[model samples]
Target: MSSIIHILQTQGGEIWSALGQHISISLISLFIAAIIAIPLAIVLMTHKRIAEVILQITSILQTIPSLALLGILIPMVGIGTVPAIIALVVYAVMPIFQNTYSGLTTIDPDLDEAAEAFGLSRAKKLVKFQIPLAMPMIISGIRIAMVMIIGTATLAALIGAGGLGTYILLGIETNNNALLLIGAILSAVLTLIFSALIKAISKLSLRKMGILFATLIVLFGGFAGYRSIVKPPVNVTIAGKMGSEPEILINMYKELIEEDHPNMKVSLKPNFGGTTFLYKALQSGSIDIYPEFTGTVLQALVKTNQKVSHNPEKTYQVARKLMKKDANMEYLAPMKYQNGYDLAVTQSFAKKYNLKTISDLKKVEHRLHAGFDPDFYQQNDGFPGVKKAYGLDIASAKTMEPSIRYKAIANGKVNLVDGYTTDPEVKEYNLVVLKDDKNHFPPYQGAPLMTEKFAMAHPEVKKTLDKLAGKISESDMQKMNYLVTVKHEKSSKVARDYLEDKGLLK
Candidate 1:
C-alpha cells in the first residue's frame, strides 16, 4: 500500500493527465452512441421488422472481439481516438438501443388509450406519455453502456490513444503491481462516478434533462473549436513497443532530439504496441518514430524469401535496404547490442540434457515443455524458424505473457522459454541461453526507424538520433533493463542517467 501511494505521489501528474484523457474518450463515445441509438430506436418502434434487423446487427457488432475490431478499424480509419471511439460506440449501441426499444414497446396499452382519448398528438404522446414512463429503462441502458465504455476504453492505449491503459500495460510489462492496481482502481472509480451521474440524471424533470444534454453538446462543440484554433502541431511523435528496453530507448530518443532542437514539440508514446502494430502505425502516419530492430525488419516487417546473412553489419545493410525499398521507411544505424531471441533453460535442465546448442534440443525434444509469448509462438522467425532450422519441436508448448514466461521457467512450471538476450531475468533466473550453432537467428541490433518522408524532412533529427548509433552495448542495455524492471527505477530517469554518464547529454 505504501508503494502504491509512493507511485501515485511520484506519478500523480501523469495519472491525472491519463484520467482526463480516459474521461474525454469515454464521454465522447457514450454521447455519440446515445444520440445515434436512442433516436434510431425511437424511429424503429413503428417498424418492428426493421428494429429487429438493426438490433441484430448491433448485437453481431458487439460480438466481434474488441481488439480484432480495433485492428480492423486501423486500416479504414487509422489509429488513436477516432478508431477507439468508433469501436466503443459500436459496442455501446446495442445496449442503449435494445433497452430503449424494449422500454417503449412494453408500455401499458391502457395508458396509450388514455393519451389518445385526451386528443394528444403523436409527438405529445411520445413526449408526455411514453418517454416519461420509460425513463428508468432508458437510463438503465445508458448506464450499462457507460460502464462498458469506461472499462474497455483502456484498450485505446494499445493504438496510441492515451488513457489509464498506459499504466496498466506498462505495469504488466515491467511487473509493477502498484501501477496495475492504480489503473484498475481508477477505472473502477470512474465507473462508479458515471453510474452515480446516470442515477441523478434519471430523476431529473424532462425540461432539466433536455437542458443538460443541450448544454453538453454546446460545450463539446465550443471545446472542439477552441482546440482546433489553440493547439500547436506536434513536430515529432516518437513511440516504442512494449517492454522496459523499448521504453528506455524511446526516452533516450526523446531526450536527444529535444536537446538538439529545443523549439521542436516532441511527444513520446511508450509501450505503444508490438512490432507489427507499430509498423502499421508508422505506415499510416499515426506515429512518426519508434525503436525497431534489424531482425524484426527483415523477418517480420519486410519479409524476404532470400536467406538473411548472420553477420551483424551485413544483416543491418540488408534490412536497411529492404525497408527503404519495400516499405519506404528509413532504418537508422543500429546500436552495438543485439536483443535477439534465444532459447533458455534452467542450469539444472541444461546440465541434465548436455544442452550447449539449439540443435542439442533434439536429444530431449519429447521431454521438453516450452513456454513462449504469443509472438514467438506464432512468428515464422521464432518457433517455426527454430523447428525448420534445427529439426526440434518440444512435445508440449503453451503461450503465455512475456513477463510471466521467466517466472514460469524459474519455478519449473515449464522447462524452456523464448528469452531475449538483453532480458535481465536471464541472469536473475539463472538460465543459460543455448547457442544458435546453425546461425538461424538474425542480428537484432536496435535502432530508430521512421517513414522516408519524415526522415527526409527532418535530416537534423536523424543526425541527432544517429548519435546513439553503436553507443549502447549489450551489457549496458542489460543493466538499464535491470534498473527499470528489477530496481523499479523510472525508464526516463534511467535513460537520462545513462546518457549523462556516457557524456551524450548536455
Candidate 2:
C-alpha cells in the first residue's frame, strides 16, 4: 500500500497531464463526430434505405484495431496528435451516428404530419418537432461515444500523444502493476464522470440551461487555464520508439531545445516496437531522430556483411557511406557505448562442456537449445546468417522477447542465448560470454540517425552529441543500461547526470 502511494506521488504530475490530454482528445473527437454524425443521421432518416449501409460501414471501421489504424495513418499523415485525433473521431462516429439515425427515425410520423398540417414547412417540422423529440436519444448516443472515446484515447499514448496509455504501456514493459492500475482506474473514473454529466444535461429543463452553461464555461475555462499553464505547442511534434534509450534522447532534446528553441516548438510522439519500426518512422518522417546501432543500419538497413571489426573508424565510415547512398540518412557521432551481439551460456553449461568460442560451440551445437527474438529468427542476416557464418546446427530454436531470452539462458532453460554485450544482466547472471573467434556478429556502435534536413537545420546537434564519442566503455554502458532497464531510473535523469559528470553539459 505504501509503495502504491509512493508511485502515485511520483507519477502524479504525469497522471494529471495525461488526464488533460485524454480530455482534449476525447472532447475534440466527440465534437467532430457529433458535427458529422448528427447531420448524417438526419440524412439517413430522410433516406431510410441508406441507413443500414452507413451503419454497417461505420461498424467495419470500429472493428479495425486502433493500433493497426494508427500504423496505416503513419505514412499518410505522419505522427503526433493529428493522426491520433483522426483515428479517435473515426472510432467515435459509429455509436453516435447509429443512435442519431435511430432517434430521428423512431419519432412518431403523426407528430410530423400534425406540424405540416398547421402550415409548417419541412424545415420547420424538422426544427420544431423532430429535432426536439430526438434530443434525448441523440444526447444518449453522444454520451456513449464520450465514454468510448475516453477509453480509446489511451491508445493515443502508443503514438507518443501523451495520455494515460503511456503509464499503462510502461507498466506492462517494466512489470509495474501500480502504474497499470492507476491508468486504468483513472480512465474508468473519467468515463463515468463525463457520461453522468452528459446524461444529467440531457434530462435538464429550459430553466436548467443556466447550469449547463456554467458547466460549459468551467470546462472551457479549465481548458484555457491548462493551455496557458502548460504552454505546449499547437503544431510541433517529436516522435520515437518507447523505451529507455528513445525516452532519454527525446527528453534531452525536449529540455535542451523544445523549451528554449524559439522558432519551432516540440512534443514527444512515441511508438512501441523494434528498430525496424523506428527506421520506418524516420523514413516516413513520423519521427525526427532516434538512437540506432551502427551494425543494425549496416546489416538491416544496408544489407552488409556481418563481420565484427576491431577498428571503429572503418566500421563507421562504411555505415555512413551505406546510409547516405541508400537510406538518405546521416549517422551522427557514435556514443561512448557499444552493444554488440554476444553468444552467452550459463556458467554451469559452459563448465560442463568447456565451451569457449564459436568453434567450440559447433562441436556441441546439436545438443543445445537456442533462443532468439522472433524477428532475429527470421531475418536474412539473423539466425540463418549466424548459422551460415558459424556453421552451427542447434538442436532446438525458440523465439521470445529480448529481455526474457537472457533470463532463459541464465536459468539453464536454454544452453545458448543471443545477448547484447553491453546488457548489464550479463554481468549479474555470471554467464559465459563466448569469444567470437569467427567474428560472426558485427560491431554495433551506438549512433544517432537523422534525416538530411534535420541534420542541416541543427548543425550544432552533432557537436553537442560528440562529447559522448568513445567516452562510454562497455562496462560503463552495461551499468547505465542496468540503471535504466533494471533499476528503473528515469532515462532523462540518467542521461543528464552522465553528461554533466562528463562535463558535457554547458
Candidate 3:
C-alpha cells in the first residue's frame, strides 16, 4: 500500500495530465459517436432490415482487437491521438447506436398517438415527445459508451496517444508493479466515475439536463480548439523499446537532444515490442528515432537473414546499408558498449550441467527449459534465429517479459533466460552467462536509428545524436541498468546521473 502510494505521489503530475488527455479523447469520441449513431439509428428504424445490418457492422467492428484497430488506423491516417480517437469512436458507436434504436423502437404506441392527437408531425413527434420520453434509455446507452471509452482509452498509449495507459505500459516495461497497479486502478476509477456522472445526468429533469449539454459544448469546443491551435516549438518525437536499457538510452538522448536544441519540443514514446515493432513504426512514421542494436537490426525482419553473423562491424554495415536501401533509415554511430544477448543460467544450474557455452547447454537442451524476451524471440537475430544457427532447440521454450526473465531463471521457473549483457540482475543473481561459442549471436552495438528525411531535415538533432556515439561504455550502461533494475532508480534519473557524470549534459 505504501509503495502504491509512493508511486502515485511521484507520478501525480503525469497522472493529472493523463486524466485530461483521457477525458478529452473519450469525450470527443463519445460526442462524435452520439452524433453519428443516434441519427443513424433513427434513420435505420424505418428500414428494419438495414437497421439490423448496420448494427451488425458496428458489432463486427467492436469484435476487432483494440490494438489491431489502432494498428490498422496507423498506415491509413497515421499515429497519435487521431488514430486513437478514431478507434475509440469506432468502438463507442455500437453501444449508443444499439441503445438509440432500441430506445426509439420500444416507445409506447400511446405516446405516438398522443403526439398525433396534439397535432404534431412525424418529425415533431420524434423531437418533442419520442426522443424526450426515451431520454433515460438513450442516456443509459451513452453511459455505457462513456464507461467503455474511458477504459479502452488506455490502449491509446500504444499508438502514442497519451493517457494513463502510458503509465501501465511503462510500468510493465520497467518492472514497476506499484506503477502498474496505480495506473490500472486509476483507469478503472475514471471509468466508474464517468459512468456515474452519466447516470446522474440521466436522472436530472430534461430542462436541467439540456443546460448540461451546453456546458459540454463549451468544454469540448474549447479543448479541441486549444489542441488544434497550440503547436509545439519543434515537434520532435523520440521512440524507444520497452525494456530498461532502451528506455534509459532514449531518455538520455532526449535530455541531450533537448539541451542541444533548446527551442525544440521533444516527446518520448516507448513501444512495447522493442525493435520488432519499432522499426516498422519508423517506416510508417509512427516514431522518429529509437535505439537499436546491430544484432537485432541484422534480423530486423523475419526471413531477411538465413543465419546470424559473428562479425559485429560487418553486421552494423550490412544493417545500415539495408535500412537505407530498404526504408531510407540511417543507422547512426554505435556506442562503445555492445549489449548482446547472454544466454544465462543460474549458478547452481550451471554447476549442475557443466554449462560453459551456448553449445554446451545445447547438448542437454532437450531436457532444459528456456525463456526469452518476446523481442528476442521475434527477431531473427534474436533467440529463434540464434538457436537455429547453433543447432539447439529447447522444446520447453516460453516467452517472458524482458524485465522478469532473470527472476524467472533464478526462481527455477525457467532453466535458461535470454539475458542482456548489460543487465545487472545477471551479476546480482550470481548467474553464469553462457558464451556464444559458435558466434551465432550477432553484435548488438547500441546506436540511434532515424529516418533519413528526419536526419537530413534536422542536422542539429543528427549532430547531437552523433556527438554521443561511442560515449556510453559497457560499464556505464550496466551501472544505469543496475540502478533501475536493482536500486529502483527511475530511468530518467539514472540517465541524468550518467550524463552529468560523463559531462554530456550542459
Among these predictions, the greatest lDDT belongs to 1
Which ranges in model 3 have alpha carbons more than 4 Å from their true place?
A: 110-119, 227-231, 301-308, 347-356, 360-370, 396-400, 404-415, 428-430
The C-alpha TM-scores of every prediction are 0.96, 0.78, 0.90
- List of clashing residue pairs for candidate 3: none
For model 1 the local lDDT of residue 59 reads 95
Candidate 2 stretches with Cα past 4 Å from truth are 108-120, 127-137, 205-239, 249-273, 284-286, 303-313, 341-419, 424-440
- Top TM-score: which candidate number? 1
Separate clash counts for every candidate? 0, 3, 0
lDDT of 1 by residue, 334-403 (tens): 9999999999999999998799999999999999999998778887779999999899867999998777
For 1-506, candidate 3 gives per-residue lDDT tens digits of 88778766886888899878888888889989999999998887778899999999999999999877776677777778898889989999999999989989998889878877889988888878778877777988898898889889988887777888887876776667777787798888888888888877777776787698789899888876887789564467788777778779888889998898788888888654445456667778777888888777666642354455667677777878877887788889888888887788888888888999888977788878888887777766677776787888676888877767777887888888888888888788898988888776777898899899989888888898887787888888888888886766788988888889888886
* Candidates 1 and 2 compared by TM-score, better number: 1
User: Candidate 2 lDDT, tens digit per residue, 189-242?
Assistant: 989999888887787664475576668668877976987899855333445554
Give me the displacement of residue 279 in model 3, in angstroms: 2.4
lDDT at residue 144 of model 1 (Cα atoms): 98
Of candidates 3 and 1, the better by TM-score: 1
- Could you tell me the TM-score of candidate 2? 0.78
Whole-model Cα lDDT of every candidate shown, in order: 0.91, 0.75, 0.81
